[model samples]
Target: NRRGLPEGHADVKRMMTVPIMRNDEIVAIVGVGNKAFDYEAEELEVFARYADSVWDSIQVKRVEDALWQSREIYRAVVENSTDSIVRCDVNGKFLFGNEAAIKLLGGAEAAPIGKTPEELGFCPAFRHTWDASLQYVVAQGFPASFEFDMEIAGRTQTLDMRFAPEYSPTGRVVSVLGVARDITERKIAERELARREEQYRVLTETMKDVVWVLDIESSKFRYVSPSVYALRGYTSEEVVALPVDHAMTPEDRAALKALTLDRVAEFESGSLAADHFYVDQFPQPCKDGSVVWTEVVSNYYINPDNQRLELRGVTRDITERRQAEVALRQARDTLEQRVEERTRDLTRVNAELAAAMQVKDEFLSVMSHELRTPLNAILIMSQVMLEGVRGSLNERQLRAMQTITESGQHLLAMINDILDITSVQAGTVVLDRALHEVDALCAPLIDRLRAEAATRSQSIDYVCPSEPLYLWADGRRFGQIVRHLLENAMKFTPDGGQISLFVQPDLDRRVLSVRIEDNGIGIAHDAIERIFQPFTQADSALSRQFGGSGIGLTLVRHLVELHGGTITAESAGMPGSGSRFTVQLPWQAPPVGSPHGAILAAGAVHGPHVVLIADDNPSAQRVMGDALRAAGYEVLAALDGIEAVATARLRPPDLILMDMQMPRCDGATAIRRLRQLPACAATPIVAMSSVVVPNDRALCLDAGADDYLAKPISADTVVDVVARHLAPGRSLIDAASGADARPS
Candidate 1:
């Protein structure tokens, strides 16, 4: 009955119900007494105004609810963040701090709302710097960040801090918001990483091995060691420009890549064990287009920056080692063939076994000569290359040649040593007996030893008499004995330890007592007696740690005995306790039949250092004499080789300048004859000739000249040649640097 009708009209049919009008109040009510619509236009307009008012209130409520939710979300984000966040006014009062901020400031007591940085007791360090930074940001209205250290809760912390100004609507910075991160652990880690990088850099640059790092993704070398120059004849920078396969043959490269990729795949798929490395050997081309055998070892690791796997490894040029193995194999095959042939004639072989041993000894001597010949050439050529004889060389090439020369010299020394020991053992060392001045021989050796000692921070205290101690023995072999003892002392001595060599003469006994003592690692009591035995050492482990031929002492003992002498060793067997080696040799004074002893005296030189010039060519002799005279050297001219030797013995010059070819006797013959005299034994003799070839120099050296100089010689060349040979120390240490570690 009341449908579409005003409320309260159900009971009374004529009743009119209108909502109470409070200007803009209710337009309608659910139970209001119904008012019949007798509509006036103004009345409807008033109703519309009331409806709009109701809609306005509801919209206001919705907006307020939405803003409440947004504030809550922002509050949650600030609280949950790991970063320490704080909001402060321009005066540096803490307006607000998040959870992380409170925790970082030692939980709430040290830092709280309205408290300034000065009030934060948990982290007093960096307070001044932090305050300054905040003030700057507030004044400048800019963002700033810095790293500083802080003492926090008994631990030192490195903080990464940032400050930003929060502006008001008027564009003024009212407060500064700061964020601090404790990056203490990170900074320590970074420092450790830097230390490791520097260590590796030093190792690679100094090591003889060639280490490399490669970018697998780019298929390029990223890092190459400086030592690559020695192995491949290429500079590190040059190697970086080369592709990984640039030096490999196509087939080898393909095979290598296939194996490498298979390993990589296995690693990625977890089929390969962790930390497994790959090993390979292949022939690689050098800068000179020669092939070298290389042994490579490598492993893959991910690059932290790009997250890509890379290759890092060391390579060794094993060409020499491989060549030696081949030679040994060839020698074995030859021996097996000879053995089979001898087996067919065993009866004949038994009859000539002693003869066969003699042949073997001769063969070894010939082999030694053959080896030295090429080695001399190699040493000369390497010197030429190092000096840029053909053209100027870069640093890499120079260093490479230096290493080559050093290695060649060391090999030559080893060959000489082995051959000598073999010859002595086989009773084939024929002594070319002559008068040798111990003092003169020791001069050059001590100089060499001092150079060696300087590298190890060791010192040699050598004391000998001013007078020459003449020994009638093989001069070369005697020199070898002293050198071996000195080298042995140096090898065993620790850094900063002292090695003492004293040569004392026993006039009554007609003998010399040479003592070489070192404060070093000593020998065991049981091993002292056996030390002179060939191939025997105090401990085998020492032989491995400190490399030796195991024949050094054996050679020393034999050489000493060969000169009618005896050698002995004494040690306490305690670590850091020293050992002493004593050698006694028969000391024979020089021949007294000649009156040349006065001229041979050390202080007898009254003029410029005397030099003997011997040349059969009349014009040549004059030119040589004039050159020597112009250089402030007293010249003793000899018309021929025969006269040269006689004159050198009579007038013991400081130097002998000899021509290779002369009448009646050659320079070689003259040198040999002069060397036999005690007065001329250690004189510096230089050969001047048109031939500067290595063979000619070797021949002259074999004949006992100190050095060789080609003819067309200038006065300056003569002076320098004389000066060097007179001193005879051209830093041989640099030539045999690596070998100095082992006793010769």
Candidate 2:
């Protein structure tokens, strides 16, 4: 009472004070004064009860005000949300939806009350899903979320939706609240990503090389290609499930892992660029429990989504290469020791051997460069004239050119035979193996040879399998081998003789036999044994008459052998009975993307196409330029490096054909300068070199040439190379008339 009304009253009539208590705690004092009648105990008690009631009313009003403010805050949040928000009654009917939800639903400000998702014309599947989720929330008295697709507008849209039950005072569920988000774009991106991953998986499975992705930290394969099976008889699925170092010897595995970890650390710390891929070799564990040497090339990359470093790599069986290297070393050591043993008596032999080697080296260099360069020009220019890409020619001239072409081709064949023999002797040539389709190869070859056969008065017949045949081999060498057999048949078959070719696969044996038979001058029965011997002919008289190097069959045999196949000759030894050469090659499907190594198609491109040819040889320049002009490209000829640099600077051409061996600075040097200039940095520059050596190619590439071509480049090669380099997103290739071999 002392604490009531501040103890200051001016009226001094009557006063009453009551304590406002909540849960038996004094919250405040309620007081009233200036009563006219005297107050008794009963009246005071009544006044106290009235005061408690009044306090209860005030608390109730305060609670109502707080609730209204909280609702206003919620409304503000809902209106401004980018996601669609909706409120629904217990019967799965929409109570209300935000502006975003209305816009998403594509309506003109219509009330959403009493409308179900089905009534709103949502897809039935999605509506059913929503109804099920809402029912679950209502039943469980909790929240639920799901992702589903709906066609609100014309296009389908993906949405993430969540439903939460709203309960009444009695804990009865009355309504539901939902938040929906339009994730259509995100869903589309996810599908696209899945498609690409599936595409990658297909490509990986088709590869001949063991391609894999590794989680570096876990040392486990995240992905692997089917080539693992071919390499060591392990399925792609099996390999991926194995540890990263599953195929290495324990010692090699430990060492390699350490090395790999160090490299990974460098990659993560920014010391090494992701662009660089490193190579490592170690022994691999085969599914058969055998160990084979493998060469692994790997690059570090950061997976964007997970931000984890990953290793993408390809592995190849390198046991043969390693063995070859060791054999070479042993041979060298033996030769050195033998020389030392015969040191006193071998002075004359050593001098003779050195002189012989020098002569051989000079011959090879001239044959590849000096000899082939001029021949390339002649054959290309002749071919262009024959094709009528140049002006028309009379019959006599055309026939003469045809004679010239045949002669040049003969000379080229002779040159190639020598090259192959040399490579075999030196052991320098290795197979650039790839996949090829048998039909695709044979069709073009037969078409090409038919014209020559017709001229020779030889009628040809060919039989192929009903189904498409695919095999793994060096397409160029395979084509070459087949062409040789056919050419031999065509050459020997007398005028009006029939040459028949047969291709059939032995499915059970997994081998394919290409049988070529000619009803021409057959081998003598006595001399059949010497027919395939190198540099030997069936008969001296027949050799003179047929006009052949006699080594064609020898080279063919070698090529077949290199491809791990066999060749056999059958003849009745009666002249005019013809001969049969059957090459039985093992059946293997070439890796994916391998057939492309042999074929190139340059689609029509819009262009006032400019091609710049930089060569010191005027004849070579003339040859390539004419070919370019024929292929719808404007030609720019540069005689030397200086001129090439100047012309490129004056007007940047779409492509540059840089000759590596040039006066006053070579093509490599010029390429370096041209690449330094921004205009030519990305311009395709194919380095042409008469050196025909691996080192020369390495030098050209190191100097920034986009591609490299050895000498003996022909018109078709020139045209093809230009088209290949100019074609959208195609790699450069060799200009040789042989196999359209891609640049290594």
Best by lDDT: 2
Worst 10 residues of 1 by lDDT: 735-744
Q: Which lDDT values do the candidates have, in the order given?
A: 0.77, 0.79
Residues 526-626, candidate 1, lDDT per residue (tens digit)? 99988889888889999898878778899899887665578989988899899999998755343344323432331122224567888777777655554
lDDT of 2 by residue, 362-388 (tens): 889776887788889999999999999
Candidate 1 is scored at a TM of: 0.40
For each candidate, how many residue pairs have backbone atoms clashing (under 3 Å)?
Answer: 4, 3
Model 2 stretches astray by more than 4 angstroms: 1-17, 31-43, 88-93, 109-148, 163-177, 213-229, 233-246, 250-258, 261-265, 287-289, 301-310, 321-744
Clashes of 2: 3
